[model samples]
Target: MAEGDPSYIDYEAFLDPDFSPSSFANTLVTSTNNATDTPLDLSTPLSRVLFDLQEIDTHIHALTTKSALPLLSHTQNQTAAADHILKESGTQVAAVTQGYERLQKEVVQKWEAADEARVAAENSLATVRLARAVSRCLTLGKQLESQVAEITGRSATGAATSVGVDGASPSAGRDGFRALERAAYTILSLREMFSAAAEDEEGYGLDRVKVIRTLRGEFVIPTENMIKSRAQQTINRFSLSSNSANSSNGQSSTSSGYKQARDARARLATAATTLYLLSPEPKSSTTAVDYKPELLLSTLQGYMHTAIMTSVNSLARALSQLPSMDRTLADISTRCQDIVALEASLKTLRPPPHPLLASTPTAETQAAASTNSNLLQPLLHALDTSSLPSYYWRSLASSLTSRVQEIVNRGGVSARTLRSNRDRLRIEIKECVLRASRVSATSLLAEKGRSGTDTVIVGNWEREAAVMVSSVVGPLGR
Candidate 1:
């Protein structure tokens, strides 16, 4: 309202929900006149109040009339929106219910068939695995049979063509060794397969099959035994006597004796390799009674034992007959050379990996078998030395010490002769070491084509020579 007007009203104050008529009247009266003024005229104020009320009512009517159509239109639009939303929600809910029903129906209809298909797939896979296992078993069996036939054929041919007094032919020996190696490889393959099948969950009943059992009993075990026997025989025939004679005569490589010795070594190497392949795995049992040495190691240890015993006996006999000392030393040196040569041959020989082993289920086993193929490592480990020559010499020294002590304890002519030749004994011991080292080096150089200027030294040969001399001379001096 206008400030100059006599009938002005604050219509905005009346719109407040908390507005009170008495409070408004008091404020208006206070704003119009102070308390010191004459009492307010009631008639003028009442008239102005009525006029203000009429003006406020008119403005309210006009505002309501102007907003009527727009309010109706807004209400209708809201109602239509609510109906459309309800219809769309019903349609979506119906579609979802139908989709759920269809999905449940499909699941109920196909559950049994799906289960059957899964089971069939599993059965098919198991059958395939079983077929593969059987195929491998039969293949190994045939290979084993073939190897046996070849070995037998070679043996028969060797027997028929026996021109020598010993009934041995070089070609026959070579062929026999090759056949044995092949047989051993086949047997190993079979054993590995059996082991793998035993560990495999899918390879159920493989070992119990009649054909597998038959092969294992009739062919595998017997062939394995035969190979061991033949290999042991070959190792036993390894003699230093022939080698010593050939060396003493200064025979050329073309000589019959030299060629025979070479052939013998070749056969020995092949046989050793075969034995290694056939050797059983090391047992896990820690008990001494339960533990058994591998076949190859035991055989090699026996060979070393035999050599030691023979040398001790020969040297003891020579101590009595001093004239034989030179010959005995020569023989011992030849034996050392043979040992060196054998060590070289074994180190150089690497057996081919079995083709089937790679395809076997056990990779750790394949790796282990490959590592065990090194023939020299096992012997060296058993002998407890890195150098074979050093082991042999040191072992001989230790063995001869007691023997020489016993002989000198008798105080007879042998003892007197040994005491008189103490200096000569020392010299002879040194010469024996030098001769063995020289000849072994020469043979290795010739075989391997090593540089001529390369010096060959047996590990601590000087100490070994001292040990040998003391073993004999100490007793004499005492």
Candidate 2:
């Protein structure tokens, strides 16, 4: 047989030589291992073997069917489909990862923005609180004014009952001084705080003008009025001294009117200086009159002028009844001391010039004329020279000088727009003083020194009055 032939291994004898014939006798089988063997009848031992062999064949056939050719052919296609799906899932996972990252960044930014907004809210709230505090200060200032009024009244009335009451119980006066000082200090602190807030032009919440007006109405005006009243009362007390005293000099030995007048003058100076400092500086031409400080200053100046005039008029009236000029001169000389004190008060009233008012070329000429207008000219011209004696002009000059000095001293520092107005006032008062002095001197010489002469005796009185006026004017321009 050829080696490659299907029947390469011929049927061979495989029956066991020792096998009993009976063992195979019952089996209906053919033993291919033994070519000489014949078909046999079925038996118990052979049947058992046949059954075990059949079970094994059945398992092999089942396994072969599961791994059939058709099923094997679809394996590649399944594997390819799985690969495509896995690739698609990978891409989706990457996209999801990127989206998650973006969301995380957005969340972080939102949190940061929220934090910033919270901080801004807090800053705004702080500013509002400061503004409220400033407003409350103004309210308290009003209350303080009322309390001061009551205190002043009580002090005035109490003064009559106790001669050395204030001296004995200095605590009351010291307490009053401390209270006034405390209130003033509080007002200044508030003003400084508000001014700092206003410096931040972008974030400033409070109205500048409103703050100024509040200070003026609640603080400055009340203080001015109180001082004015005190001065008047002091003068009134001095007037009573002459009636009560039995001194040979016809003046009170207990309290001289001259000394009292000096005291009153000092009080007025203190009031004027305080109010002037309390006033706000003007930034521009429009704000010059609009600013509370400016308005308050103007009001104070007018008040001081009126107050001084009242005192002067009162003194003049008191002395008018006297027969001798010597007694009147002595009294007038004492009042003149206030004029010297006026110089110090005037220095405090002046402010730095505003740049805006300096640059307005269009109104320059008109402004100059308006500013230069003399306030005293009309007052002097309108006076009834026929009714008033020549010596009356001397008293008038002395009073006018006090008013003029105040304006002149403040001229350099006041706003340009306001300066002209003050100058006008100063000029008027100064001119009026000059005119009155001239008239008084001419009248005195014509009536007294030149009585026998045909030509009017051009006496030394004109030179003396001129020298006095020149002395006051010298300090004014400087």
Q: Which candidate number would show the highest lDDT if scored against the true structure?
A: 1
Q: Which candidate should be chosen as best, given TM-score against the real structure? A: 1
Query: What's model 2's lDDT at 312?
Result: 56
Worst 10 residues of 1 by lDDT: 284-293
Clashes of each: 0, 16
Residue 204 deviation, candidate 2, in Å? Answer: 6.1
Model-by-model lDDT, in order? 0.69, 0.42
Under the 3 Å rule for N, CA and C atoms, how many clashes does model 1 have?
0
Least well predicted 10-residue stretch by lDDT in candidate 2: 437-446
Q: Give the TM-score of candidate 1.
A: 0.61
The digit string of per-residue lDDT tens for model 2 on 1-478 reads: 2224343211232245665545554332544233364653446446656775676566568667867776777887899999999999999999999998898789867888898999999888767765665566566556555445433533433442222455433433322323432343444554544444444432244445577466766665566456434433332222212211222132242224334333433443334334433455464444222223343345433434543466455433432222342343444432332232232233333332232223334565556534423322122233422212222434455664555455445555432323334444344334433333222111111222223322222213444345434433433553
